[model samples]
Target: MAANLFVIEAPGKRQALAQALRAAGVRDVLVLATIGHIGMNPQGFKPLAIDSEYRELAYRLKPDRERIAREIEDAARAAKHIYLASDDDQEGDVIARDVMRWCIPEEDKGKVLRVRLKSLAPSEVRAALAGAAPFEDASAARGDARRIVDRLIGSLSSDEGAVGRVQGSLLLELQSKTPVAGVMTYVAPAADGRGDWTAQLPVFAGAAVPDEIQAIAPLAVGASRQGTLANHVMAHDEILLSASLATERSLAEVSSALQGLYERGQMTYPRGKHCAVTPEAVRRITAIARASGAGFVPGLFTAVREPGGEHSHEAPNPMVIGLSLNRDLGLLPLDEQILVHVARRLIECGVPCEVQAPDPQQLRGLPAAAQGLAWRRRDAKGAVLWREPIKAGYRAWTSEQSLLHFMSKNDLGRPSTIVAHVSKFLNRDLVTQDFDLTKKGRDWSAHVGRLFGHQNLSKIIENYIEEHKKAPSLMVADMIEMCGLNNIPTDQQQDYEYEDFEISTGNFP
Candidate 1:
């Protein structure tokens, strides 16, 4: 007779488990999927109605779920034994609980087993089958606590606050906590009349910039290499935005140059998700940098990139160091050296700094409103503006900052899965940003806050779920309490209104 393996969700892991069990010599193994949950509160806020002491909390199978159930039932009929194998997370635990409620029967209860796992491998699968432990119904109960709380919140939130649904089918992935505090600036940059203000902009070797950048405002007048440089910044906005402001050369210039290269087909795109660096990529770019001879580092690097969204992910750009033009090109000037420092540091995480002589008067300017205005002599000790005065925009986040910049730091979300969550929301049109939230997005936020009680609703849900995990018996009570509290979206509430939900309008006379 065939044996069945019923997994509530995670087709990938379930498939792997099936393969591993078979490889381990457990023949007659048939793996099946549930897609997700089959049972949940069917209609309204009242989900706790009891029925025949089985707690018939009504749950209707979703269309996809019904299909999965049919397949599993067919498999179960052929099998003498069954296994509930799901993921390692709490969500997986809840899925198992649902599986037990549905597929397994009381008469054949002893023939079924729960297979716990950390990873899916032949050895692990074999070990699980041999030890077929009783279902940790309590563990699944913890997940039920979470599911119940989510349902309660979704069903009963009051009309005073707005409700927001983030991207991702599962709320656990989208929910997060952010810090409520941030740092304040109490200082200013050293004033050097000659200090090019554009250093605030960043640079890359082959970046591009438009000529209009230099004409954005008065700051562009006689700006370093104005005509050529602004184009460079526009050309290299990516690199410029990516570099530290503390560096000597205008990050604008560097980034713009990099952009120009790309637009001109001289370089590859900087914004990409590739982990593997091409050998030709390193060689061709390096040779060009050495020949055309740009950047403070003119000699060529071995070129290495890190994986995925880490702080210092590898850039596709090949870099060169020390052009060594001595008499011809001359040593990298103090300003130039600073610019290079910013670029190198931009690729890594955190702040980069170096000690330099401070212009006295510029030091004096630190205590005033001159902070915002263009530092004509914000640090002027007569004519020359001292270049290194703890400037606000001087030091900046690098490639690494993009990984940790928003969400967690801003108390928007957590680190583990925040990035993907934000990306998903962006894709779903649920959230928008330009330096901050758009009007529609802000309106949505207001709606959610109004419905959810203006307090930390995300935290409230998180705590509720966590508490339920520890005490399964608390689930029904918690869910009941949660659902009784109204806060669904106004649109959904209106559309599903009892009055709107009508039966046959025309009667047969």
Candidate 2:
């Protein structure tokens, strides 16, 4: 009898899954890999007009007809049972669906099978091949929607200048959903901070840094100076994902933001990425949110970024991967101080952080000390205005470092991550990407972009970044609309609502 043949996309993935399945007592299965799909549709924003029955999404397959023909011939000549086990995301779904079109029997529809597997572990691989569900057309359809969105978005160029790169589509799907629909990100260092990124040990990572300030030191610094955040730590930082924040919150702002959480009773110990929010906290926070007058709440939401149940997985988050414990131990930068703050803020808001809720009078009483720091703001022409913070609560300095990340020509994640993260965004459709600019990000990037001549010659360049700091009035509304956000919290006015704070003029801290 001919060996049953299974074809998957990636060689490594195929090998891993194959070994696991073999270990699970499947002996006759021959796992082969095409590496990837030979056939795919060219990407675009315009949807292929289905028959108006909504049966099919409008999309085009790729230009690789010859390759598709070769794949079909190979599939036909191989084992009697052909399985198309591609990556488990839309791109993979599309690949399987396309491959099936040629190899599967038109009448019985059983000759070819599309298998979905989550990971290469033995049980999952065995379960996947054991004949459960075929490829989901809905998954394929959603894939089509994504491709169309991408095509539309590509003109927007490389998913940049947009907030929530991962949650880009969600803002569209969840226009009228319940309370809040938004995107959040979960970012991690490529690896342990030292010699090899794949290295997972803590000791080497800590010693690799120049300062020898083990990750523990940074966390110590954060915990020690918790005074910086003061009261707002008690107020909610109000965001969901760490991934979307890279562009929005810098290292400084993140550290500054978490201080507010330390003041709030929501987090037990600030900072981590455990995805560890418990059932109790979720329930409690959801109720408080409903009572706080923000309606449209969902029953309970999933913390989507949780990874392997393995206690060893380390990444920056609300409650695990402490900068003190992991990242800062290696040599790092002040920017990491900001990331530390972000981790703390994420932890505080992950479940239900107790906040005093900024009161306008009290906010005014909080020092408005935007003062002396060594930073530069330049026009498109490199004309620089150094903004020295002269007051507390006043912004200390201005620079356009963020523009380097957002405006640069790189899409941050690979095909797999992009699909997974975006899928999460699509499923709930509650969140928008972190497209809305922080007062600093927008000012710095805009100035630096024009100064560096990165902008196309379409509009006149002007540096009015502070105008964005206006009350959550018409301008704020306009910004919210453009960024595609909902669930306007009451504290929206704290930034623009306060004209001047009570801090003595020229106060640095």
Candidate 3:
């Protein structure tokens, strides 16, 4: 009898998921891994080809993945049913579609189905297989659009090394910003003698320190007001930021570790951008928190619904209730550290607390020297006199956390792609680890800024996805012209080549 085939993106998931499938009584199924994207053409000026008018995408298997492609084709030919279980996101949908186009024969196309395995838990895997559906064409189209647009931008501006819709904008944003001279932080012991509360002030060059602030060594607190803590759950970017800070690892390193935990079913999907967790997920986390003796307050966690429409994923949380991070699951020290942070976040989610601080209006009524010591009073000077906390609540955010939050708010890139973009910038020396732009980076940013201002490229892509949902077509030439980049050299204009994989127009419909 012909076997059923299940394809996934990560090789690490094959063993565990295969076991889960077996346990779920999913018989005669062969699990396979794509490793990652298979559409990259190393030798071509462009990674893939796009039809000038219809915006249809043509992809070629990378040389290194040729054997894997052949294996997929052979397996697909013999398989009774083929499940493209890569991922449920846009990138994953694109990968699934590409597998069908490049590997499965025309006759075998009907057997192909898309399965979204949000987690590798046995139940989730079983449910995903049971609910397998057709490939998401719109999501695949959006992924294709992103690839095409990024490739077109990079190829046209080959002189600049690597440029992307989001990456370029981020580079320009970094290049355009002026660095602050210094920062002053003030700390005071808690009124209840618990710990210290702190505040910060940014000092620019040539800015003078206020005499009043300098005089106030330990600021006195006046009338205090009670405030509720902002019950904010961590998003993907924030998790990355927190993990990176806690582990002293790079964002890329933390992301890799988190992905590893996810593959092993120790954590939820790591690339989720939302702060909300599903009601079921919240319940699981709460149970885990109680079992693990972590801080668990019933009905305290905020933001517990899917806010980003139907396709949006829940925030990352521990996958297994009472899962041990120290278990000998081949977890690295970094992975364990990151997993601990994730578990802590889940346990702490929705735990209510109160905060007490000096009233701003009351502080303003004080003498000039006392007023200079007010929290976040920049007018007097860039020095925070002191911060006294009456109650414990939310934790202070780090600089990197603030930056990632900003990036997320502005849609600089998806959670999955943001770390890679940052790593690319660092590897290419475009931006220093400290986020300062080098001369080359600055020059390139200036050039790209002239063609497409910061955020314009992302906006154009967004608009394209929204307007052309059916036949998403944004030609390279059209985008160039849209960006006011009309003076392209003749040689560079015609550099891209198309590899025909015998794709027929009928295949698309």
Candidate 4:
């Protein structure tokens, strides 16, 4: 009997998805993994193989992936139905398109379909296969355009080292912010005797400092402020940021762990841009929270529903509601920790809390303090004093969290690509883990600013693609020429050889 063939990107997901198919009563299905992009431009921009008239580009399968290609072809030849079950992102669309072009026989193309496996749960998998559609040609084109633009930027700015449309802009943005030097710390005793809480104020250099602080001081307490702990459910970037903070792991590590859990069907798609939760998801999560004895105000639980683009999915949430984070999942320690944080965020988003803090009006016009040390109210002899907090509220966000929030607000990158772009800075040794730009990073940022004129070139390219529905090679070429790289000797171009699969801009397959 011919089998139904399903192709996916991550090898680790093969077993889980196969099981899902079985649970869904899907029979005689063969699951295979492409690992990742099967093809890439190994020789840089010089030999990118663009057609002169239509500006179409060609890409070939990587040499090591030839055997996999053969396997896919062989499987396709015998399969009753071929489902390209890749991710729902641009990269995934490109992979599906590539598989269609390189592996599936032309005669069998009629039976080939694209299925977006957002999660490996039985229902989702069954639904995806049932509703399978044609590959997203526009998304694949966007992905290809990004690849070409990034490669062109890299090759043109090779002297700067590791320049990218988004990465370069992000590096410049990071460089613009100044790190705090010191802070003023104030300690307050809890009136009910639970414990003492502290409030801090940023202190800058050149602020006048009093010689002695009062031993005891009275600060005006502001009215109690009540709200939910977290304003909304965790989005992709927020999950990465929160997990990084809770685990003290690098974003790259957190991203990997999240991806691992996602592939295992332990969670929903983790790379979604929007923070919205479906009404059904909200009901499920609320039920789980109640079952776990988590306290949350029903009235305060706002169901966040934001409009999203075609590639967007709901915010990250556990696939199996009420599943134990510890025993049931058999997750690695790091994965468990990350999921725990995610669960906490989900619960807190629905929980209400009140905060009290010292009134800001009373602390206005104080002397500027340093970044590391606290400013205190002391006696004439420089003795420190204790004061109760007149105001209570959430603690200040950490520098890393603030950076992530800034990136999210500025649309610096998509949820799928934000952490990777941020990680690239650290990987290239251009920025410290603290997000401070190194000398090399600063120099690169300067070079990019000079060449690209400080605009968000990535957004420009993205907007162009969204509107024009094609690669902006001509626009990019013009930009490069404006950067004074119009002319180059033929001898300077590097050479390489590979099979070519040409795609036209006017009409794509």
Candidate 5:
């Protein structure tokens, strides 16, 4: 019999899963990697045969992808069965469907099965193989919808002489420069009988500043200080990802490294959103913590899964790789240290945190006054003056402990994509690692474009998005109505030119 073929999205995952299958006593398996999406639809000034015309996408594969597809096709022809073991996410589902389309011929399509493998552990892979299911079209449909909409918007924007939505908006924001703003201060009496503390309230240009805020009656607002967040330690997924931008690691390097780790079966699936802790992981990490005696309490914690997340895997954990907490983390390199930090965070999330909920009885006899108040005023140079408010209740810099507690409480971005987005922003020169503003000044062209070139551009796109929801129809009507393509004929000619497609901002096309 021919070997059973297993297709994964990434090469690292392929190697990892292959190892797991072999370890689980599976034989004659040909595991291959698609290396990500093999194809994408056309963008830019492409020929559209109809209004709101959804282009018939011809997916162009790279040379390597073509080779891989051919290999899979040959294997599919000879194999008794095939497994679509892509990532367990929407994008991954789409990739699996696309792979099926390209690699498995009609006759051998029936041999294809989908296995959701969130972790590369041999045991989970074995279990998944036993319970593999048929590929779902609904999952692929969502990805298709996103792709179609993106293409439409991109094509339309290109025709209209502008970049995509965000870049266009950024260009508009670069118009007028404001002068230096002044600061204002105010004092509010403390409820705890302490002296008055100063507060700085933000003021904006052309807005009237209120001289004083009236504290009608002191409402006993319960407040607790979580502590200041640490610069070295990552508290949440976003912060962890942003660390890549600060470090020497490029986005590609980080992605490849993490994927390699996952493939090595040393890490869990890196694409998790919430910092949820499993009982088993917690127990193991607690043991490690106690054994290491890292000067912190190994508090046991119970973490609930965040609602509305992908929910396929737990947050990225170090224990997936059997990381040793007792190992000297300080001696490790930056990358290894990062993994260690992630591991520590995963364990810390479930440890019983001390979040003191305000007691109603504790404030029974406190003085009643406005909890906090500030003053604001307008300056002559279009700058606003702000007075800071000194809050009466517990307020302090956010600490690492409080940061972990907060991450344990809220739903956040996937551990994988957080770093990706952060790195993207950094690469774009949008912000600095030290949280400094890099692009503070405005671009004259963007301002001019926003004012005259595409005044109603944002509104039109918004309408299209809203209408697309009601009916995923072609954007032809929108193109005709908003883009002023009224006279353009929707016929076989395919040569209709948008002669009036000129934005006053410039020929951004």
Candidate 6:
């Protein structure tokens, strides 16, 4: 007998989700897996196909998906309704679209439904089944646009061809960095006996203090704030950055392991575009921190609510309540274990520091503009009151946390591909494992410097997409010429003779 069909994307989640659904008293549902994507752009440099005046790329299903497609067809025929249970993301929506096109019979198409499974927990799955929504057309369209652009870029900068826009840009950015050097300085509030104060004096900005500033030693110096340091919660990219830097794991491996944890309901969604956490997530994180005997406080993390938009999701967190990072999940690999540690530290960051205001007299010499009014310096007699040495040097590489934080702040790549793209720099030898300099050359450096410096590539791509409205059939060089920005010209092609190229409608001279 045919049963209601539930299609999932990941093979690993199929058994778990099916068991969860059964536990929730759901019956007559046969869950199946697409085992990730089944179709991709056709081979060759042709990313665009012209058909009946419409330009669209052909997506061919892999031979391996034939059996899965057949099984879906058989199940769809018997089922009264088919729920496309896929991950709640753009890529997931595209996968669902493919499954729908390949498997769901046309006559029974009305029976097909789209449901977003945020997690495979029994409650989540049951809730999804009860309140499943229709497939999101906007998401699918966005995915299609991305795929077209990606394929276009890949075709232009194939393995044997010139480096692509992103690669060229990053390389340029790193190569142009002139390593800066300077002296460190420190300052603290100091006042005359009569209690007259001055603004904060200029401290140094280098490794060691100059003899001039160190000569004006302060009478007293103490901590401006007390209690533990409150660092902002770590994001997924930050975790990956740390793990990749510290351990032998690549960004891809670390990200995959983290996502695996999310799919199994051990952690929150691994791929989120923003670092903002919902109130519920904050509460759970607080509870977890407190349970772990870390001092956790509420209202410490100022929730940066995102103005509504597509692809905005909360920071990665634990979905399952009371998940002990140390005891409960000890069996995960060392790298995955680092993810838990990073997550815990992020939660602990919400424990606000207990700050005590300094005495007004001590603030006498301190500048009113100075927020942190404590420092180490020498007194007039040259006695070291206290020395807080400013540590600054060349950081050849970065931890997952720092990299993730920077990228998130700058609105870089999407959660799904941030690590993948970053690892490419390592793989391509643009930078070393320590993030030290490499010999990628000047053109690459200029491209990267321009990209990171001005963040113009996105603008260029956006303009191109808006103007063209679709992927162009032109070669990479042609696309670069039309990108409407001063991209780094290909080294060999820079001196080539110019000629007008024929575009879709007109000649781009």
Across residues 189-281, which tens digit of lDDT does each residue of candidate 5 receive? 434432243446434323345455444222222443332111122334443434343334444565566655666666667666544534444
Q: Indicate the residue-level lDDT of 90 in model 3.
A: 73
Residues 438-475, candidate 2: write the lDDT tens digits. 44334333433432233221111111111232221333
The lDDT per prediction is 0.40, 0.34, 0.62, 0.63, 0.49, 0.54
lDDT of 3 by residue, 387-438 (tens): 1243322233343444464466566777777776655545566654345677
- RMSD list, candidates in order: 15.7, 21.5, 7.8, 8.4, 11.5, 10.1
Better of 4 and 6 by TM-score: 4
C-alpha TM-score for every candidate: 0.44, 0.36, 0.76, 0.75, 0.60, 0.66
- Identify the leading candidate in terms of TM-score: 3
**Stronger candidate by TM-score (3 vs 4):** 3
Clash counts for all predictions: 74, 66, 2, 18, 25, 25
**lDDT of candidate 5 vs native?**
0.49
Q: Which window of 10 residues has the lowest lDDT sum in candidate 1? A: 226-235
Residue-level lDDT for 293 in candidate 1:
32
- Candidate 4, residue 279: how far the Cα is off, in Å: 3.6
Stretches of candidate 1 exceeding 4 Å from the true structure: 4-8, 12-15, 43-56, 156-432, 438-447, 450-453, 467-473, 476-509
lDDT value for model 4? 0.63
Residues 1-509 of candidate 4 have per-residue lDDT tens digits of 24899999888878788888888888898988898998765454444454332243445788788899999999999998899988877788889988988888988888888887756655556666677887655557767766666655554455555556777767766666543323445554433443343546643223332222233234444455666656788788878876775577777788999889888877777887667765545666677666666665556767555322356567887766754433322244788777766775676677655545545554453333211223222111111111122343223435445556666656677776776555454457676645667788788778878766777766666666555545445554544454453442222233334544332222000
- Inter-residue clash pairs, candidate 3: 300-350, 301-350
- Judge candidate 5 at residue 17 and give its lDDT: 72
